[model samples]
Target chain A: MEFQEAWPYVVGVYMSIWAVLLIYVIVLQNKLAAVKRELGSLSKAVERKG
Target chain B: MKKSSLILASAGALLLMAGVYLAFFVAPDTVVRIDDRELVQFSQKIFYFHVPVAETSFVFLVLGGLFGAMFLGTRKRSYEQMSYAAVEVGFIFVLLVMITGVLWTRAAWNVWWEWEPRLTTFLVLTLMYSGYFVLRSSVQEESAKARFGAIFSIIAAVNVPLTFVAGRLDSLKPVHPKVFTLQGASMEGPMLAAFLVSMFGMLLFATSLYIMRLDLLRAREDIEYLKEELEVG
Candidate 1:
């Protein structure tokens, strides 16, 4: 196959890896932040009740 | 994030970048000769990342099954959480492998997909794992959910080796290239170096993701327990 014909697949494979990693990391960060916030509130609730 | 996980992620990212550089700039292009004509296959570059991701997915799925079995034997909440996290991370890598594999297939085989043994078995593995999440959601009782999930995970893990060997079995007639066999890898020094670096990086990155997901699962469980305690108090 011609070099030009095959280069797009190489680029696509690399781009897919990068894209998936970026999206996964972002999702994890958001979930972590949300969990931390919930935990903080729960801790305060316990302290206030005690 | 945990310090260890962060360190692993950073190191993995760096190695992956280095692998990319080596793949493009250092490793020689793969050339195939047919009828006295040499063809340079630029698409073979995808092999470095595609195989690594596929192998890494296998590792995570196997770990998930091991953890699931441990959870069943000991009834440990931590093991259950670890199994769930590993499966989730494994699912992500499996999806990546499918995507990259399709692209490579298009480039190399001039087709989007084929029904060869390796690809067919891998597709089955992916679908089975996808059902894992659906099964997890469908069950109502917590204990039952965990029980069923663990059982399914173990069953699914058995397919991993089957998929790996499908390409190598003579009767299967798989078009998938077998780079590592009983003999050894078929590539040269620089190509091997690139593959090793990428493989390690992919494994570490998946590990980091697994750790993060495990922490999240535990946090959610803790919150549930705390909420129950508060309600009782």
Candidate 2:
């Protein structure tokens, strides 16, 4: 196939791979942050109870 | 642990970027001619990332099954968590492989999808592992969930070989090229080098991600333990 015709598929594959990885990373980061916040609150609650 | 993970992540990122650069600029383009028309298969460049990610997914799936088996034998929470994380990452990589494979198929075979053996088996493999998560969430009890997930993961791993051997099982034509053999790759020098670099980069990246996910899961578990202690106090 011509470069013009094939370039789109190449670009699509590259972009999709990166986009998926980026999304997964972002989601993991958010989950980590949420768990950190929960840990903080739990620690404070435990301290007060003690 | 955090410092080491950060180092791994940085190195993985750098290697991945270098691999991408090599794929686009250094690897030689494949040329094909059909019906008196000379065409450049520029889409072949996708092979570098696609093959590596697909292989990485298989590796992660195998690791998941290994950990699952260990969890079943030892009844350890840590093993189950490791198994779960590996399977999760494997699922994501497999999804990317499917998407990229479909795109490459469209470019090469002029079709979005086919009912070929390899393709069909791969889809089945994905679905089987996907059931792992479904089974995990459906159960309410912690021990039951772990036991079920571990069993399913081990059983699901059987599909990996099925997927890999699908193309070789029959006389059916396969668009997916068998690049590797006992004699090494059928590609040119630069192309093979690019592929190797990309594969290494992807493996490193996947490993880093797995470590990060495991750490996060451990942290979450610790938090839960603290929460329970706080409530009791």
> Interface root mean square deviation of every model, in Å?
0.9, 1.8
By lDDT, the best candidate is 1
What TM-score do all the candidates reach, one by one? 0.98, 0.94
Docking class of 1: medium
User: Which whole-number lDDT from 0 to 100 does residue B41 have in model 2?
Assistant: 81
What's the distance in Å from true for residue B161, model 1? 0.7
Give the worst 10-residue stretch by lDDT in candidate 1 chain B: B220-229
lDDT per residue, candidate 1, B20-133, as tens digits?
999999999989999999999999999999999999999989999999999999999788888889999999999999999999999999999999999999999999999999
Best by TM-score: 1
Per-residue CA lDDT of candidate 2, range A16-49, in tens?
9889987887788788888888888888888888
- Candidate 1 residue runs with Cα over 4 Å from true position: none
Candidate 2 lDDT by residue in tens digits, B1-233: 36666677678778878888888888878888889987678878889889999999999999999999999999989999999999999999999999999999998888999888888889999888778888898999989998999899899988888788887654767656788876877999988888888888788878877987998889988998997897677
